[model samples]
Target: MLRAGEPGATGYREALEALCRAYWLPLYAYLRRRGCNCHQAEDYTQGFFARLFERQALVRADPTRGKFRSFLLAALKNFVADERDYAQASKRGGGARALPLDFGEAEARYALAPSDTLSPEEFFDRSWALAALQQAMAKLKAEYAEAGKEHLFERFKGSLQVDANVASYRDMAADVGMSAGAARVAVHRLRRRFRDLVRQEIAQTVSEPAEVDEEVNYLFAVLTASV
Candidate 1:
């Protein structure tokens, strides 16, 4: 049986860890793009995760009100507002409040350069969408691995992407030693599973179930805008 956000065996600690792993990059990127120096961004990002874990916020998350990304951003905004002064006042022995985060490297990887065409808000939205997709993919891969169909999953995983230019069903069937009809069915099932996994991933972040569609629409808009 799959144990996601269920009450029993939910293991709040484990779930929080997973959520941090999944969202830390997006949060970090958001902070960096907002003009925080690398060190401050890292500190803020780490502190955000620490606070989230300390508060057991995930236990009370309800996917019925809004998208998880919205909730997280709002929380992050509030955290920064509340902690800015305190964080700025505190300093290391060197007398620098900044924690010496490698913002340059982070910038190269996650931050958008001024020359980039996308606005900060657009960048954050796209980053959020990609992060959500990655989380969904990770869960799907784990499910396939657990079901002993890892090979099948790898064979068709590329087809899930919008711009994959995936192989024809006949070619996929030949590669997998399955009939063309089976290959078609397999791809359909794969898409269905991916959608379910993506929905579940988004669901875990929000406060209400109704927010899933809204989030999905926003994500798609981000993707579309990028292209």
Candidate 2:
């Protein structure tokens, strides 16, 4: 996603930082799954970002090629392959201009992932999908908060992409101070908004607009795959 443009272009730095924030956990988890201990994995992940910035590796990306995640994972695998020592990386990683990660929270979240024999790549794909969904949801929630409809958002969030089946249209309509028809319309609008937000989120992780739906479907498949 951050690899969409030239290295020194406007907003490139911010884009890079955002991408790092969205993905560092998944990368760290992949490293851990590959047999790296916490400290080693942390070092490797940080150092990889550092290298990306320092070397401007993103400028080498060819948008016509493939998904951003695949490009990134390939780069990371190469980085790890070339690194001679984790101890040295840990020492140097302190000076790397990488995004800060809350290791405690990251490890706690990783602990909740199903531990049934998944490969590192499989785990990374699932984690990345979850992260993308979370970012979209957070953005949607913030939009409602800014509109002074935070409570309404909370009540209707379950209807963003599903019927929920917990309440009838009339029942939900009463809770939201709307008639059943209006409530149904509200639900339809929210689902469309959510779908647009998801598309936007997926678009950022791809090289082209046409790839967004393809990427979105792949991510959902990854999330649903057997652990």
Candidate 3:
């Protein structure tokens, strides 16, 4: 995000574009909670990115102020509030080149708890935290795959957050063909590595490293609420 802070920087677009690709879902979820239908949410999500590029959002973005996710949410709010942009976004064809976001399963994936009704802002935070967790887990799985431990990751990932609910280490070790103590240590190390990966994921969006811990705490809080 430092690229966004730089004046006339070459990589700012790439940096923000990466963010757009990775986090479009949260924005979509926000729009949905704001009363948009599936198609409308998809349009607004893609339209925001299209307008983002058109307006040079990176130049106007100041990461020094706060987290990149906040900037995106605020910018998206502004975009949705504009009557002209809303009208334009609703159009099926207006020479608006769409961003390559896959919305095929967007509606299907959006399963809000029947008992839990959330405001748009709450929805955004919940979605944002979930997105970060998903990104972190994906990165961790990729790392494990590179190390020839993909199967282990799949088996142990369920126990990443809670150990008490899982089977005893002896049972897991017998299933995985490892000593019980080694299995316990392996899961311990996996949990530690996952924490580091999650922190790294949070660090990517903030200007200062100090903001990472706050963001991480907030992320978990938001996710826990959804549970």
Candidate 4:
């Protein structure tokens, strides 16, 4: 992402936009949990990214700060503190460029967040975890589609996380026209594949391959904590 921070770099703008698109929801949810209403939170989130990229604040990232996610949250908190008037700020004011963020969907998603007194940071962590899990699942589904097994994947995927004793292999077998034993095997393989994809997804966010496991554990911990 350092390229994204470079002035006048080719594709830097697109790279930064992609990054914002991926993480904006979590940031928006974080702001909401801090008591910003939907419109206020949307404005803050849009302004935050606009100012963040325009000022090239990404150049301030340091390995010592650890995960990029944590660094982002810290930067956002600093931005909000300094830009207290964001609630009234317009996209054109302060030369802030408008991004095409979908705040309507963002608010819809935020409405499903845990209501059990989670701190803003915890909510951000949970949102990040959910986003990563979603990306992994999307990738897994695409691979199944490529192999012409999308139907099978769909029928067996529910068992990937369900306890073997709780999941009905018989029902899945009937749905997929497979024997119960084959349905069990399909779920086993799909679960293994899904785990690998999740690890791969985590690998993208960390500084090193060694950090993937630690990040994975942290995200899963956040998920369980939310539950």
Q: In terms of TM-score, how similar is model 4 to the real structure? A: 0.83
In model 1, which runs have C-alpha deviations exceeding 4 angstroms?
Answer: 1-17, 53-65, 85-115, 162-167
Candidates sorted on TM-score, descending: 2, 3, 4, 1
Q: Write the per-residue lDDT of candidate 3 for residues 1-227, one digit (tens) a residue.
A: 46654446798778767767778888887888888888778777877788777664545555557898898898888777763554666673233545776677666557643336778888888888878778888889999999999888887776796773335777777778898888888889899998898788778778888989899888878877766
Better model by TM-score, 2 or 3? 2
What is the alpha-carbon lDDT of model 2 when measured against the actual structure?
Answer: 0.78
Q: What tens-digit string does per-residue lDDT give for candidate 4 at 1-227? A: 34444447788677667656777789999999999888778777777787676754556654234676777788788777767675346533333545887777998888777688889999999999988888789889999999999998887777777766524888888888988888888888999999999887666566567878889889889999887
lDDT of 1 by residue, 21-135 (tens): 6766667777767777776677776666666655544444432345556656766777777575534523311233222344455567673433467765676677788878987
Question: Candidate 3: lDDT of 77?
Answer: 80
TM-score, cand. 3 vs. native: 0.88
Candidates' C-alpha lDDT: 0.68, 0.78, 0.76, 0.77
Q: Please tell me which model should have the higher lDDT, number 1 or number 4.
A: 4
**In model 3, how large is the Cα lDDT of residue 208?**
84
TM-scores for all candidates: the values are: 0.73, 0.89, 0.88, 0.83
Query: How do the candidates rank by lDDT, highest first?
Result: 2, 4, 3, 1
In candidate 3, which residue pairs get closer than 3 Å at backbone N, Cα or C atoms, i.e. clash? none
Off by over 4 Å in 4: 1-15, 63-65, 91-98, 165-167
Q: What range of 10 consecutive residues in model 4 has the weakest lDDT sum? A: 87-96
lDDT by residue for model 2 over 19-55, one digit each (tens)?
A: 7787778898899999998878877888888877675
Error of 2 at 187 (Å): 1.2
